[model samples]
Target: MNRLDIIQALMGQKNLKNYLEIGVENGHIFFRIKSTFKIAVDPKFIFDATRRFGKSIINPYNLNNQYFEKTSDDFFAQDAQRVFSAKKLQLALIDGMHEYQFALRDVENVLDYMDDNGVIIMHDCNPQTAGAAGCFNDWEVGEWNGDVWRTIIHLRSQRPDLNVFVLDFDQGLGIITKNKPESTLLFSPEQIKELTYNELVQNREQWLNLKSADYFYNYFDLQRP
Candidate 1:
């Protein structure tokens, strides 16, 4: 399943209302989400603002979307309180910088504002190749997953309070929620960074709690479409 399908299913199952999306590049996934209130954060958006507003005015589903043209950090630091004052954050998507530190901070920061039982979906946790998982200096024009998988490892190791796992699809769609984790790792941050892609591949399923696509469908009791 794709991010949108997972998101919409979770929204339906949880009766979620408020939505937050970080790293909204083209509004490809952001605008399509159905929520009572929605927030989008990105330093540089590829979509036209006027078109977004027009779509908002035209469709009830697209309405109430707030866009912040700033880093996720700045959005949380400056504008989070004002918006969250009225609505409790229910679900969020973290697809920003695609690096470990940024992705980790985005999760932590957004968690503070999330309602009970809230969920956060993180993108790029599963880089298909070692080249895709390369660090920023090695960044290329296409298919750079960065080290976001390390964030998952970090959370899985240190934060037992959160349930963390990667659904083995769509470049490793990560699901994070407030619950007891099914598995835990013993790696320190330094050890995680020191880990090689080959090492990760060796213990991929255990390290990431990697579940098959069938697992997701079964977990949610949703049919394949």
Candidate 2:
């Protein structure tokens, strides 16, 4: 399944109201979401802003579309409370920096502000090629997954109590929930940083929790009250 499919499936199962998306490149996924109160955070949003989603969906607080043209860190530091405004953050998508620490921090930040039943979707957890899963900031544009997968490994290792799994589709979409927030960091960010694409390839069996897309739906269904 693609990212849209996964999101659509989850949307079907949950009544999402407030949504936050980081890294809205062209508003492909950003505008598609029908959440009542929506926040899109991107350092640079490259979509045609005039274009509309063609739906008159109402939000909890009647707020209009909120877009922050800043990094996720800055967006959270300055506007997180304003964005949620005492309303629980129900859904958040982290498709930001694509780096391990950045992704990890994004997850952490979302968890800190999320509702008890909130869900976080992280993109690029499964890289199909070394070219796409590189550790370097400078990568050849062909399908770069960056080091986001490391964030999954780090989360699994550090927060085993959290409900986390990686969908084996759309280059590895990760679902994280079951709030067990903590102040722990990976023992050594450098150790995870030092890992190369080759090392990841060699250690994939040990680091990734690869799961079928159906598994996610089934798991979510079971979690439903």
- Native-referenced Cα lDDT, model 1: 0.89
lDDT by residue for model 1 over 36-111, one digit each (tens)?
7989999999989688887777667886778899999999899999999977799999999988889999999999
Question: All models: lDDT?
Answer: 0.89, 0.77
Enumerate residue pairs that collide in model 1: none
lDDT of 2 by residue, 2-111 (tens): 87766666666777667888998887887777666788899988865345333223222323678899999998899887777778788888999998888999999898
Model 2 deviation from the true structure expressed as Cα RMSD, one decimal place:
4.0
lDDT of candidate 1 at residue 144, scale 0 to 100: 93
TM-score of each: 0.94, 0.85
- lDDT, candidate 1, at 98: 89
**Poorest stretch of ten by lDDT in candidate 1:** 216-225
**lDDT, model 2, position 158:** 82
